[model samples]
Target: MASSMLNGAEGLKLTGMRSPHGLGSMNSTLHGKPLSKMGLTPFNLRKDAKFVAPKCSLSSSRPASQPRFIQHKKEAFWFYRFLSIVYDHVINPGHWTEDMRDEALKPADLYSPRLKVVDVGGGTGFTTLGIVKHVDPKNVTIIDQSPHQLAKARQKEPLKECTIMEGDAEDLPFPTDSFDRYISAGSIEYWPEPQRGIREAYRVLRQGGVACVIGPVYPTFWLSRFFADMWMLFPKEEEYIEWFKNAGFKDVQLKRIGPKWYRGVRRHGLIMGCSVTGVKRQPGDSPLQLGPKAEDVERPVNPFSFLLRFVLGSIAATYFVLVPIYMWIKDQITPKGMPI
Candidate 1:
């Protein structure tokens, strides 16, 4: 795909191919349901902060730079173990739909049956099923850390032809240049060092191969981070492009996928997704001419702000903590007079 094809929000303007999903028409209802149903709003109501250049500044205190909900290796293991039960039936459908997967796979041109593909962090094989739509299922491999999730994936008919393996995204078990296409979805947030994982994706793909990574976009508020960071990493648009380029991938472009379902109220922090695509270049090819270096958006440094965030996060956390207690109290108070 040419560089101009990824015109960001304008849409995938591929030449010679009049895609039913083309010309930024992926958002149109002709392709499927309304954007709201597919988990997209008409257009994001959030103000465009891209025009404002972020200032470079000195490092701040540890708490300021430190992300909330930082998970240790053990915490991640148990969290997914619990999540795997409800993941397929409850979680996967809300965000990553079949249409989103189609858009993510569009640039790869995977029509050839001979292409080898890998779905990194391919939990429950949701993404793997989508890959099989265009290419042979036997050509794909699904790698994830959770065996509980993998077991469910193995039971799916669409993924039966594919190979399943236990692996880490940052340190993949595959040899270098092993796959023609690399794709990951909804899993980047848990990566301890996401850039390292992106590098691994670049290392594993053959020259001119493409990788598509999908994840939640950064939420707008510190309070938002308190909720989201507990589960995933939400990198900004420029950060996604930067990670791909730094990993030596060419033609990096990012598209904001959706707000998903619509709400009547104009909410302060709307959730959006990002699909960042990049291609592996040939060994002797010239280095890609990258755009401006990514800038860090500065915020006011106040100890009181951190304290306030902690209190707010604590309150939210406490509310959930108190739910069972409240439920038990209600149960105790209510008289159970009828028994069969």
Candidate 2:
């Protein structure tokens, strides 16, 4: 048993494999085995707060030099982290959808009746279990930025089948057109250039791949769900639809999953964000081949959207006159250069 050293930057249980000396120990919560290159050790089981933006709202702006999202452990505790956590019921077949009632739910083949899923930013393995029963773990990849979270996943995760890859969403370390299905489950919303993450998903998806995205659950009020980096940026469905188009995904379906309340106590669940499921368009695919592009997506516009903004603009102006700034300063603290 080699000794493990904690990397201050990431609260992950880094093993020796990724270390230069190859002397680091495996993650504590993972399978109690030697780790490979900060390797994956699956175990399983388990497990957000108020994300307040300062003068500049989260989606409003951030320094280019800064990471899109910072997972500050101590401060992130109060977050409603349990939204992804569903314990004990993961192995139950009764919980599966009608399509998978008789058959195993395979995330890898989401459209083909199987499921090869990569749970991007999949923290705590809550959703993985939900996915595992529906699909084979071998077909699932739990990718996230935190080793600590991955460690927790290892404890309850189905190691024999599922995998844990540590990497960033904007610049994934996988080859292009890799996964059959992809999901963020409300995680990618934290990425700095959320578009990049969407593009990466598009890049690594097989033709006809389905990218199911779930952003934070919030009401219609813009500021109501305007959280910090954890729930910081929310990209327009158009942005994702555009990236998928550019990256070769067709049949893009963007639909919002609204919030669910329990007994009138607003449970911070999925709401007010769109779930985009797009199929990767292959070479020579026709312009009229598949689904609608982001620009073409149509929904009944809530007339009040225009009215509310108009009213807020008027009322806020009455109490305190203000002028919106068109030219904003870009932060250069973080690397904004193109990804490798």
Candidate 3:
């Protein structure tokens, strides 16, 4: 039989294979037999036997510069970092225009100069500028995480009076019940957790404070996939309602700010946008009803929208295609350079 020994000096177990004789030495044979006969495999235990570890490339172990998967806020932070330069001049003008901002702020009733307002994720001060138009700029606070975007906002002459701070929407750093009005626009699409951000809005708003959240509507499935590069979340109207109610908001109402069509079969603003407004009720007020109500959808009994689409389509085709063809035909028939 072979015996196993514990090499206390080296802190290693010397496992000896069973043989007809006794235990084998590390390099020598057991009794009169060789290591092979003793069924013992030789291990190179020499002090100078350098261990050659498997080659590990740093490239394989290192993390990537950009994230593998897109995170909403992180992607938006980087997106706006560069886009901030062209945001107000190029993007905001076409989409979230001054008219749209006015429409969003209509419900807030910012007429009172004493009303304190906070615009969460207010990048480039597009919405902030609108708020200050009604309320005093000194009473307004605009908070956003991207310094690049906020830097442009800070340079705005009107926004200079408003306080600008860097902060997150989901976890606002402000005190509870800090503002009388909360408004967020063109920013909710980038919220990683829309519900959490809304809750923060509620937390920072005082009793009877109005909170208005404006964002893009859920687009057609194909459109959603195409906009995947933008890393935006288009919430349906019901989602906005649910988010507000879940956050303990009262008097919650969903309003379709843009147009609708096809007897409400297709919403004109489905891809364009929508706004949800809710008021923080006083303690005694009743709880808000949870889902969207039937009246939320305004559907016309007649197929009037189809006619509207047809008329617009006809005008577009006539001006763009038919007009050019008619002009060419008229020139050919009239003869070259002849007024007659």
Candidate 4:
């Protein structure tokens, strides 16, 4: 019966002994091991039998020169070192507000208190505070590459039970399929390789689990675009969807969110613009393979270059900080139901 299912299937030709039950049954095996043992569930087999990978519409190629001043690991590390002092107080109020954090995490589907969750690039416990609202504090783990940022997260009383550690987003330290939900907020912009970090998100999630990434979107206005380019990664909406599909996630979805003052005016772009969620259908590492790491952490850095990038990056970052305040002032004068 298992053989009958593949009778007319194209490209896939089953060879070797077969069980009486269909491939959907647990009796099926490929090379002496049960298909179930190999992470090949009935859903995967049925999908693979006729699945043709879709061609990505967007180009994966990057620019020759580094566009953003703070996109690299080293630059971001030092950038956060000082920013961590006022991140929760200043940055959160203007950009990553409590309201925005709650809305962004909703698609992550943190429904169960028993769910094991890993908040990747979770800085200062701002987003983790939202995760703890749905899941138990002990069940959540917050990982970031910035030690200074993690130190601030440790100070939060509500997140005391949550595990806080310093780790890379592009290369997570956790084992594959170790988490029920993978979440990252306001962090992808700093990643030199956004796709690699997204792949890790897929790799760490259990089968049937969800991975939600919330980050900034590119601005349309000319002035905002210039500042956004110099600041950090501001990926377009299509780029986010393409990255998730390439990572072998099924049921991919994206939800747009921003501050109330914005009034859906996305021409300027918000710091935390969209929430993208995808579910892992089958387990193990992501299918998309890449050559090497974009940024080498062990490599020596030049003192002069480091200081230059840090200064310019901080200057660009200040523009984003002021954008929300400017918008808020406009929102106040504008009528309640009108766009600011």
What do the candidate models score in CA lDDT, each in turn? 0.58, 0.42, 0.56, 0.75
RMSD of each: 11.6, 22.0, 31.1, 12.8
Instruction: Give the poorly placed runs of model 2, Cα more than 4 Å off.
Output: 1-115, 157-160, 217-219, 222-231, 262-272, 283-340
Give residue 5's lDDT in candidate 3 (0 to 100): 14
lDDT of 2 by residue, 194-245 (tens): 5556777777777766666655322223333333222334443335545555
> Order of all candidates by TM-score, from best down to worst?
4, 1, 3, 2
Give per-residue CA lDDT, model 3, range 1-340, as digits (tens): 1111111112222222111111112344424545333222233334433222222221121121121122234445666677787877655543455755775566566768899999998988988988988899999999997999999999999998899999888778988788889999877766656776787778888887878898765433332223332334556544676687777775554433432111111111222255567777653322323233222113442346434433443332222222223333554677544521
Using alpha carbons, what is the TM-score of model 3?
0.59
Candidate 1: worst-modelled 10 consecutive residues by lDDT: 56-65
Q: Per-residue lDDT tens digits of candidate 1, residues 133-229?
A: 8779989999988898899899999889999999888778988888888889877766756777788888888887878888755443344445554
For model 1 the local lDDT of residue 148 reads: 85
Candidate 4 TM-score, C-alpha based? 0.81
Q: Could you tell me the TM-score of candidate 2?
A: 0.49
Number of the top candidate by TM-score? 4
Top-scoring candidate (lDDT): 4
Q: Candidate 4 on 167-194: residue-level lDDT in tens?
A: 9998999999999999999999998888
